[model samples]
Target chain A: MEKAGIPVVQITAVTPVARMVGSNRVIQGHGIVHPLGDADLPPEEEKELRRQLVQQALEALKREVKS
Target chain B: MRVVHYLNQFFGGVGGEEKAGTSLEVHSGALGPGRVLEQALGEGFQVVQTLVCGDNYAVENMDELSVRVLEMVRSAKADLFVAGPCFNAGRYGVAAGALCAAVQAELGIPAVTAMVPENPGVDLYRQELYIVDSGSNVAAMRDVVARMAHISLKLVRQEPIGRPSEEGYISRGILRDELVERTAAARMADMVLAKANEEPFESELPVTVFPPVPAPPPVRDMSRAIIAVVTDGGLVPLGNPDHIPLSAATIWGSYSVAGIDNLEGGNYEVAHRGYDTRHVLEDPNRLVPLDVLRELERAGVIGKLYEEFLSTSGLGNPLGNSRRLGREMAQKLKGVVDAVILTST
Candidate 1:
C-alpha cells in the first residue's frame, strides 16, 4: 500500500527488506520481539519504551512523504 | 510480420457494458489500440486482423474461446499475437491473458499483453506470456501501445528480449544465462570495489520484484479508528501450537488477546529463530506491546484494538512468498481494521 500511497510505517529490525520493499516510513525496531521494549527492562521502563516507539510511529503517520 | 491483435468489444469501438455480451467478430486490418500501435511497429509489420470479443464471452467460454481465437490466428498466418495492455479491467485482462497463453502454446507464436501490476491476470499469466506494464486504463493507451509494439516486433524478428526493465515488460520469472566476459571472481571483486567507492553497481542476479500495491488511503481519523497490531516476530500461543516455522515460514497464526490487557509470562513465547528469543520469552509484551496499547486505549488516543494479532516468521522468505502472505493478511484485515501497524523482525 505504500506504493499506492497508503501511509505505512514499518517497525523493523530488518531494515534492508524494509528499504528494498520501499516502505515510506520506517522506524528501526529496537529488537526482534522487543520491537518497542526490552524484555530485560522493568515494567515501568518497558512501558515507557513501548510508549515512545508507538508515539514515533504515530508521528511517522503524520509526516508528509515527498516520494 | 503479420500480427493478430485481440480487443474487447469496447476497445474495438463496438460498445460498452451493453456490448459486453457480444460474441466474437473479426475486423480486417488494424483497429482501436492496434491502429495506435501500427505506427510504432513501423513499415515492416502489419496488424493482419483484429479479433474482437466480449470480455464476458471470452472468460465464460475460455476453452471454446481459446480454440476460436487460435483458429483466427492460424488463418491470419499471424507471426505475432498482441492482446491489450488491458490496463486494470479485470475481465478483459483475464481474457487477454488467457487468449495470449493459448495462442503461444498452440501456434508457437509469442503473445504479449499489457496490464497494471495489480491485475489478477498478471498473477495468472505473467510467467506464461510477455506482459507490458500498463496504467490502470485507456488513458495510457498511447504509451501502452508503443511498448507492446516494440516488444512484439522484437519477438517477430526473434530478437533476444533483455531484462524486463530494458524491455519495459514484466519479468517472466525466467533468469536468462548471459555469457559475461568477466569471471565470477572478477565480477565479485568489481562489485566489492564499486561498493567500497560508494558507486552504484547492479547486482548480477536481479531480484524478481513484485508489483507495488496501491497504498490504502490513510485512516481519516485516528481516534475513531480501530487499530490492529501485527508482528512477524513469531509470537505465538503457549507451546507454539500451530507449529509456524522458524524460517522461510509459509504459515501464519492469529491469536486472540480478547479481554487480556497484556501478555503474561508462560502464556506466550517467541518462535522466531532469526534473533534471540530469550528476551522476548521473558515478557511477551516486549514484542506485542499490549501493555502500552492498552494504555492508549484507556486514554482514548485511539479506539479499540482488534481482538487478535497475526504472527508470521518472515525471515529467509522469498519476495513472492512474503508478498502473498502480506496480501492475504491485508485481505483478511480489510474492512475490519481502520489501520495497521506492521512490526517486523
Candidate 2:
C-alpha cells in the first residue's frame, strides 16, 4: 500500500510476521491481547510508554523514503 | 520398465464421491484410465500395478497416506510412476499430483502426471512432475492419456523435457539450461538497448514476484504533518452506536476524543470478537492508544491528529477482504491524512 504513495507504519505483537510480510515500518508490542498497553503499569507509566512508541511511529513516518 | 499408477475411488471405478473415504487398495493391473494409459505406454514400459485411494481420504490424511502410498510404490520397484489425468475434479487432481510428487521424492523414480491447467494439482506439483496438459473434464481423457504417456516414456528414459510450451505441459516456473549462440552479457545488453530504442524484447528471466513493499520517503517534519491512527482493534464508544460487528467487522466508527485529553475507562469499549474483550473493555487504550496519541498532540510532537480515527476488527480475515478494506480505507484518507499508523491485533 505504501508503494502507492501513502506512508504506512504497522504496530504489531507479531513483529517477525510483520517483518516477513514486508510491512514497511513496524513497532513491536507487548502481547496479542493488548498491543499498545501494559495492564500492570500505572496510567502515567502506560501513557509515557505509549508516548515513546507513538513517537517512534511519528519519526518512522517521516524518514522512510524507499519507493 | 515397471510403472506404478495412482487413482482415486471414482476413477478406479470403486464408487462415486460417496466412497471418497475408502482405504488404500492396490490392484495388480491397470484399472479404468490406466488400461488405456498402459496401452499408450507401448511395449517399452508396463503399468505394473494400480494404486487406489479416496480423494477425500488422501488429502485429509496427506502425510500418513503419502507415506503409505510411497511404501506401496516402493515395493513395486517401478522405474516410473504415473497418476491420473484427473481433469477438473479438484480433490482427485490434488490426490494425483500429490501422489506423483511423493513417489518421485520417496522412491527416486521418474514420475509424470496430467491434469487440467486450472487444477489445484498443477500449481502444487507442476514443478516436480512434468504435468501434461489435459482437458477440463473426462471428454479429453484419451488425448490427455496419450500426451501423459509420451511424457512418461521420455522421463522413464531420462530424456530431457523441453520447455512447457514445446512439451505441452504447464510451466512449473522451471528455467531450462540450453546452448544458445547469444552470450549472457550480450543478451542483457540487447534487451536494455532495444527497450531504450522503443523496440520489443522478451525478458530472458521470469518476472520477479512478491517483492516487498518499499517504505515511502519518511516525513520531513513531524510537527507539521497530519498523522492518523488506524486499527484493526475494533474500538468504539461505550454504546457502539455504529453497531460494528464484534468479529469480522468492516465497519469502523470514529468517535470524538477530539477535545478529550485521555480516553476514560468505561467511556470506550473494544468491539472486537477475536480476543476476550475483558481487558480492552476496562480500558480501550490497550487496543488503541488514544490516550498516548492525545499526549503526543498536547506536547506538539505531531502537527495535528486527523480528527477522525479509523478502525475495524479483522482478527480472522480473508486475504481478499483485507486487501479490499485496505483500499477502501486508504481511499478515504488518500489526500486528507499525511501519514498512517495501522495497528493490528
Candidate 3:
C-alpha cells in the first residue's frame, strides 16, 4: 500500500521477513500465531496487553519513516 | 519409440466438471488429444498408453497420484512421457508438471509438458521440466502439441536445447556457458556505447528490477486521523464463509466489525495453515486487537476506526497474488483511512 501513497505499519513476529518484503515501519509482534494478545494471561491482563500493542501500533503510524 | 501420454478426465472423454473427482486410470491406445499428440510425434513414435485423472483428484492427492503414475509409466517401459498442453488450467498444469518432473527424475526418461507461464505450475517446475509456453488458447492445441513434441524429441535424443525464444519454452533461469564471438572488454565497450547513444541494447545478465515505492507521509494528527486494520493472519468468520484457501490464497475478504466490540473465539476462525492456529482459536483477539481498538475509539484517542477489517491468508502466497490483494485493499481504503496497521503472521 505504500506504493498507493498510504502509510502502512506492519506488525509481525518475524521482523526480518517484514524487512525482506520491504515493509516501511514494523513493530515487533508477540508471536507467530498470536500477534497481539497472549492467551495464557488472564482475560483482563490479555486485554491490557492487546491494548498496549494497539497503542504501539498507533504510535508507529504517527512516526515518520525514511524513504 | 514408445510414449505415455497424460491427460485430464475431460480430455480423456470421461465427462466434464462432474467427473473432476475421477481417480487415475490408464487406457491402451491414444485417447482424444493423445491421438493428435501421437500423430504429431510422426511415423516412428507411438503413444503406447494414455493416463487420465481428475484435475481435482490429481491436485488433492498429488503425492499418491504421482507415485502411482510413476509406477505405471515404469511398467509401460516408455521412451518418453508427455503431459498436457494444459493451457490455462491451473490444477491440470500443476498435475502435468509435477508428474513429468517425477517421471524424468525417477525413471530417467525424457519428459515434457506445456502450460502458460503464469500458471502456478510454471514457477514450481519450470527448472525441473522443459515446460512449453503454450499460450492460453485451447484452439491452438495443434500448434502447442507440435511444440511439445519437438521439445520431447530434442530431450530424448540428448540434443542441446536452444534459447527459450527459439524452443518456445519458459526460461528456467538456469545459466550455461556459451561460446561467444566477442571478448569481455569488447562486449562491455559495445554495450556502453549503445547505452550512451540511447540505442536498444540487451544486457547479458538480465536482472529483475523492482519499481521503487516511496513511503507515505506519517499521520500528522493522532487525535483526528482515521485508521484501519488489515491482517494476513487469516482471520475469517465462522465456517470460513468466503472459502479462502488455507495456503497460496488468491482472494481476500472484508468482514463487518460494526457494533462488534470484541472477537469471540467461537464467532471467528483462523484460515491459515502455516502456523499452529490453536492460540488464535483460543482467542481471536490475539490475532486482531478489535477489543482494544474499540476501547481506544471510545476513549477518543483516534478520530475513528474503519468499520470493517480486511483479511487474507499469507501462507505460501506468491508475489503476484499478494501484490494484487494489497493494491485492492489500498484502493478500497484510499480516501477513507489516513493510516493502516497490517498485522502479519
Candidate 4:
C-alpha cells in the first residue's frame, strides 16, 4: 500500500521469522507471547527481545522503494 | 592376496558381555574365529591382519570407529575386506553391515558380510553392500565364514561371480544386465489384452499429471493501490492458547490490528508448524516483525501497511489446501492492498 502512496505499519514478534517472511518494510519485536513485551522473564531480556522486534518493524516502514 | 577380516569381541576371543566395551586393535596372523577364514581361503589368500572392535563400541561411535577401521585397511594393504556372519545379534549385525558399506563407499573395495535374514541390519544395508544369508546363530559359524570367504576370493581375483541369488547372497537390487525375455511388441500386446479382460495390468511406463494453470488477474493501476501482506505461517494470538493443529492445518484466523501501532507482546503469537515455536512464542516478533514495518512507514518507503495480517499453519498441509488458501487470501485482500507479499515457513 505504501508503494502506491498509502500509509502502513508492520509488527512482528521474532526477527528471524520476519527475515524469512521478508518484506519491503518491517518491524521487530522480542517474541510471539508478548510481541511488545511479556510481563514475565527478567525485565532486561523482555525489553531486549521487544526492543529488537520493534526496531526491525520501524526499519521496515522506511523502505520507500519496493523491490 | 591380502584380505582384512572384522569380528566382534566374542568372535575375536575378547570375552562376552563383559568385553562389550573393548576397543578396536589390529593383530597379525589368524586370531580367534579369523583362523577359520584363513584356513578356508587356503595358502593362495593370506588373512594378513585382523581388525577387531567390540560391537557396542562400533555402534555407539560409528564415525570414530569407521575412521579407525578405514585407517587399518589402508595400512594393512589388504585387497579384500570381509566382516561378520553376524547371525541374529542386532547390534553386531548392524555394525558389520555399516563397516562394510563405509569401506566400499570410501575405498571402492568389494566388501562382504553375512547375517541371518531376521537381523534388522540385513534389511537396512542389504542394498548398499554384499550380504550373505546364514544360519540364525553362532552354530552356523563355519559354513557362513566359508561362504563369505569364497565370495571375497572371487571378488579379489576379479573372477565372474553369478547374480546375488545364484551366489547364495541377499539380493542387492542392483540391475547389472537386463536380459530381455520378450520383445517390446509382444509385451505391449499382452498388456492390452490384460486390460481388455479387466485383469490388473502393470504398465511398463508411468502416467503423468499436468494440471491446467489458472489465468492471472488483470493488472491494476500502480498509482491507486491497496496492498496486502498475507502469510500461511500461522501468526496468531500469544496464548495460542488457540492450539492450532501442526501438520494438517485446516483453519485460518486473522487478528485485527486496526488503529493499533503494531503487534504487541501478549497480543500475537506464531502458529507455524515447520519449526520449533519456542523462540517465536517467547517473542511473537519473530514471525511478524511489525516494528520494522512501522519504521518503514514513518520513512515513506511504501504507502500503507495492511491492517490485518493473514496467517495459517503451513506444515505438511496438502498442496490443494495451500492453493485454495492462497487464492482465498488473495481474493480477500484484492482491493484492500494493491500488491501483496505471501510468506511461507
In model 1, which regions exceed 4 Å deviation? A1-7, A15-17, A62-66, B1-6, B16-82, B87-111, B115-125, B132-169, B184-220, B239-243, B269-271
User: What lDDT does model 2 reach?
Assistant: 0.79
List where candidate 4 sits over 4 angstroms from the true fold: A1-67, B180-345
> Using TM-score as the measure, which candidate wins?
1
Proportion of native contacts present in model 1: 0.50
Q: Give the candidate number with the greatest DockQ.
A: 3
lDDT digits (tens) for residues B10-97 of candidate 4:
8888889888889897788777667888888878778888888888887999899999999888888878888887888788998999
What is candidate 2's lDDT per residue for B209-303, written digit by digit as tens? 34466677777778877888788888888788888887766666666657876667778777787876676777777777777777677788888
Clash pairs of candidate 2?
Answer: A61-B219, A62-B218, A62-B219, A63-B218, A64-B216, A64-B217, A64-B218, A65-B217
Per-chain TM-score, chain A, candidate 3: 0.92
Candidate 2 segments exceeding 4 Å error: A1-67, B181-345
lDDT of each: 0.82, 0.79, 0.89, 0.67
Winner by lDDT: 3
TM-score per prediction, in order, is 0.68, 0.50, 0.55, 0.46
Ordered list by TM-score, greatest first: 1, 3, 2, 4
Q: What lDDT tens digits, residue by residue, belong to model 1 across residues B1-345?
A: 888899999899999999898899999999978988788889978898999998888888989989998889999999889998688888999999999998999899989999988787888788878899997767878988999888988888899888988889987778667787879999999999999999998786776564554455556667776877788889999889899998988988889988998898788877778987877788877777787888888888778888899898878986667767777787777778776777887
Poorest 10 consecutive residues by lDDT, candidate 2 chain B: B205-214
Chain B TM-score against the true chain B, candidate 2:
0.56
